[model samples]
Target: MSKAFTKEEDGTEKIRLDDLPQSTHPNLVTPSGLADLKARLAAARLELENLRARPEEIDSTMAIAVAERDIRFLESRISKAILIDPKDHSSGVVEFGATIDVVNEEDEQLTFRIVGEDEANPAQGLIAPYSPLGVALLGGETGGTVEWQKPSGVVELEIIAIRFE
Candidate 1:
């Protein structure tokens, strides 16, 4: 192959990574979720700066690209965030940011907090509003039963308590 037809001789060409895709859902966020997004953006900015400052130390092209991409994603998410304080919400029914205690048909007690997509950590009992359980629990009053459509099957859960912080 001729060197004239090649574009990777000295590896001087700047690699432009593709932008991260944005979500189509509404950007609903609790107070804590918004704070987390801001913190992530700050960290990404710091990482990018550090990588640029010490570029000669290693091949940081990929690191810098990743950091820049994360910064873009976090900034976009923060910009579109609709902060909702749970304290301002009514306590009569389940809603976003509501912490609920439920008893399943198997008599197992479980707790979950309805949160935004960015703040969802199901393993930690935090669920997104669009999740099957969250969808079923939302608007449910305490002592009411809701059916959760899990991938395995439908499970009935009785809401024992509802609280907001």
Candidate 2:
């Protein structure tokens, strides 16, 4: 219902880059990102195992291509994965991968995880920082509240917690 506004000594309102942390945690693996790579590896391994089980299929070029493609993708991803230092370490501010909990006036507690654009899945409560709600909640403090516009109307949220390490 409210927002964390800062005022200068001159009584002028101050703008913020974000309310949450922007730094990547020590572990930058988005669940989806990690899962995608893992699934590919597993699929490729399974295909290799299958080839051993069914010797007749071992010589099938098409079958080999199916498994090889998965392996290639995994190799490409893990090789280029950039593990960056956590962007915002201030415990006072929210950042990426922070599991924020907010209580609406209705007393319903909502949970969200700020993630990368490619990793966002609202159905799973993972939000991309570029999203309106995510942008509003970035660099926020645990006890701070925020407001942002939604398709329906103005929506409010409280920052219950944030994690950076």
lDDT per residue as tens, model 2, 54-111: 6455354345444555566566565555443344455667776677888776778988
Stretches off by above 4 angstroms in model 2 are 1-43, 48-64, 84-90, 116-121, 130-132, 147-154
Model 1: pairs clashing at backbone N, Cα or C within 3 Å: none
> lDDT value for candidate 1?
0.87
- Residue lDDT tens for model 1, 35-111: 99999998899999999898675668667767877898999999999898999887769999999999999899999
Worst 10 residues of 1 by lDDT: 1-10
TM-score of each: 0.90, 0.54
